[model samples]
Target chain A: MTKRAALTDLPLVLDRVSLSAGATTMLDRLNLAITPGAPTLVLGPNGAGKTSLLRVCMGLAAPSAGTVSWGGRTDRGLGRRAMLLQKPVMLRRSVAANVAYALAQAGCPRHRRAARTEELLDRVALLGLAARPARRLSSGEQQRVALARALAREPEILLLDEPTASLDPAATRHVEEIILMASQSGTKIVMASHDLGQVRRLAGDVVFLVRGRLCEHASVGDFFDRPSSAEAAAFIHGELVL
Target chain B: MSEGLDAWQLIASGDATLISIVRLSLTVTLGAVAVAAVVGLPLGALLALTRFPGRSALVVLVNGFMGLPPVVVGLTVYLLLSRSGPLGEFGLLFTPAAMVIAQALLVLPIIAALTRQTIEDLWREYRDELTAMGVGPTGRVATLLWDSRFSLITAMLAGFGRAAAEVGTVMIVGGNIDGFTRTMTTTIALETSKGDLPLAMGLGAILIGLILAINAAAWGLRLWSEQRVA
Candidate 1:
């Protein structure tokens, strides 16, 4: 099998990226650079374009104006990146099979997929439910399975959209543990979240957005302790930012 | 009442002629279904996933063809395969092959149209995920088709139901030759014309029973497998 290009597409950069759908602007001249590091948690209000920004970074959505380049290449070679949506869609198959499908798509040889699937499932603490249909699993379990699937791709950059928003405390903790594990293993993590506690626990830095514009980007300590933007200050205090 | 009794007796006794007719019916209908599925499934998947000029018009044409009269299809196939027609040299007219062709033509539209709808809905649910996975066009089609297999089974059965239940196409193409091209539906039609109610009723019962049994088996299999994997 031909080898895929190594994950050298680091420091994903966006240059004045703007996205719009007719009269509605989803992303407004957002400039950001995500370098290799600890997990970066994107915090924003609803309609603040957090999801839209991740979609752009993942190369799933093209910006209407401006450009996004991975490393230095403008072409979207998605082999080195994987993403988890707010509500991950489980394939209509077994949990093990769902991971197996991702491995197969990632070009893992047929002979090695089974062992790899087991390993990934075990990492997510879902080895016991390997044979169960993935779609029938609880939402928390599904999120973990989605995490396992994203891990299956062996991505250099992992982008997640609200990976644990709907989970109970226990389940949310489980997911966070897996995410932390993934980050420690050298994969760059960029995730969006609504939970403030989650943001404190998982974020190395915070990218705060308001109405499709980037309002603040700072280290976790600085952002929460001394937020420069009025919007970020109000948002950190749980005041409505409208 | 006597005719019903005779019909039940014929069915119970497994008369040679009745058995032959039933076997031919299954052979012809299943053969047609196989042919239709081979051509229709991919066509349907393509229609669902791709966009091009005149695609809507083509979709409407396929949908319209689903309601085409079997006799009309038979007539068209007859003209194509008749002795004086373009395919005259092969001499397939009045044979089971001709009947299979006619029935395949009649059933293809139903299978294709239904498959298009099934794959389209599945594509909607799977679009973002599959695209995110970087699955290409052919992979997208294969993935959607395999994932939609349960729904597609119903589409195939609908095609089988149409082919098995229709006499007009087979009668025109097969000539209903006894011990040869005669199928359950064609036999019932011929026997009814000759006032042989018992024989017609026997074949009719077997036809209905066969359709019901196949449908039930498919439903059970789908339910069982879906529970296991869905």
Candidate 2:
């Protein structure tokens, strides 16, 4: 597969986005900008609209009255965008077939599609299980397959909603390594995570959401050292501040 | 004992009339099921996905039709398609097409209703996943229906069993014309009323066999879908 050139130039900007379902609010006037090649971590407790903000940024959920602009253009299609959910959805096909399907949809050529899937399988270390039923894989294995499928698109922006949510320590490290490698390749990575260790390891910056509102948007070093909000301080102290 | 054994010989010897009746029964049942599936699957998906003002009323109507009285359906269709009734212009009465249409009406609701239930249940899981993947409207609906293909197949089989084994609608609408629309169910009905006990019994055995086959298929689909869910 001919890998598409990396998007090392464009910025993803979500300005004053608010998402509400019925009367209850998900995201409340969240404003932030995401620079390419920087892994941004979204940290928040439950019910904070962390996932909702990612959905808005990925163009999955529309903001009630705000703009999600990619490259300063609100109307630009998110064609080169890819998002992974907490519990990834896999096709009922083989592991390799799942990757191939995503690559094909991303406009990879016929000959390139298979080779891309093979390379992804190797990268995810699931080459031996290429033909095994994807649905039957363990949770960690399924998560990797989902990652491989997403990266096969060679997306300009990668949005992950708790990609390592339920994985064990080793599994978490493996996923973190993949994200790091993709970030190095100049594919912008945006992740929502609860694990502070993971946030520290991968995110160049942190965007914190608290109760559907933006509490902090700062560099990783500054965020962990001197969080501006009491909620972030309480959260860093490992106290539940919801 | 002698009469029953002799009827078995008739069934085994490839009796042209019996063979044709059985084949016709299969055709009408499968044709109705195919048509019902095409219409009912989309209706089911819509019912499960959309939230309109009349949603509950529509659900109630569909659930009511799932258990609709077969004889009432037969009577209404019989009147409409009969020689003196509303849709008699094209002269579709007492024909295989009439049977197909009546049976499709009966079966379509069952498939549609059950498919709606299946999709509604799966929606809770798929809604977030599809949204996060940025699946658009058309793609979202199509993948939901396709992913639950096994459940829909079970729904169609359930419809098939009801349509194929039914007697009232086909007899009334098709008139059970010999060599034209005479099917297994109607043959059994005719043979019984006319006091040909042995032939009716033979047809009854065959009809039961067909029912068992269709139900087994439905059960298989259920099991396969269950395995996936598990």
DockQ each: 0.70, 0.27
- Return the clash pairs for model 2, or none: none
In order, the interface RMSDs are: 1.0, 3.5
**Which residue pairs come into collision in candidate 1?**
none
What are the per-model numbers of colliding residue pairs? 0, 0
Residue B41 error, candidate 2, Å: 1.4
Best model per TM-score: 1
In candidate 1, residue B170 scores what lDDT?
Answer: 93
The candidate that wins on lDDT is 1
After superposing candidate 1 on the true structure, give the runs of residues whose Cα lies further than 4 Å from its correct spot. Answer: A1-7, B1-5
> Distance (Å) between predicted and true CA of B211, model 1?
0.7
Computed on alpha carbons, the lDDT of every model, listed in order, comes to 0.90, 0.83
lDDT (Cα, tens digit) per residue for candidate 1, span A1-242 = 33555536688999999999999999999899999999999999998999999999988889999999998889976758899988888988999999999899888899999999999999999999999999999999999999998898888899999988898999989999999999999999999997899999999999999999999999999999999999999999999997
> In angstroms, how far off is B183's CA in candidate 2?
1.5
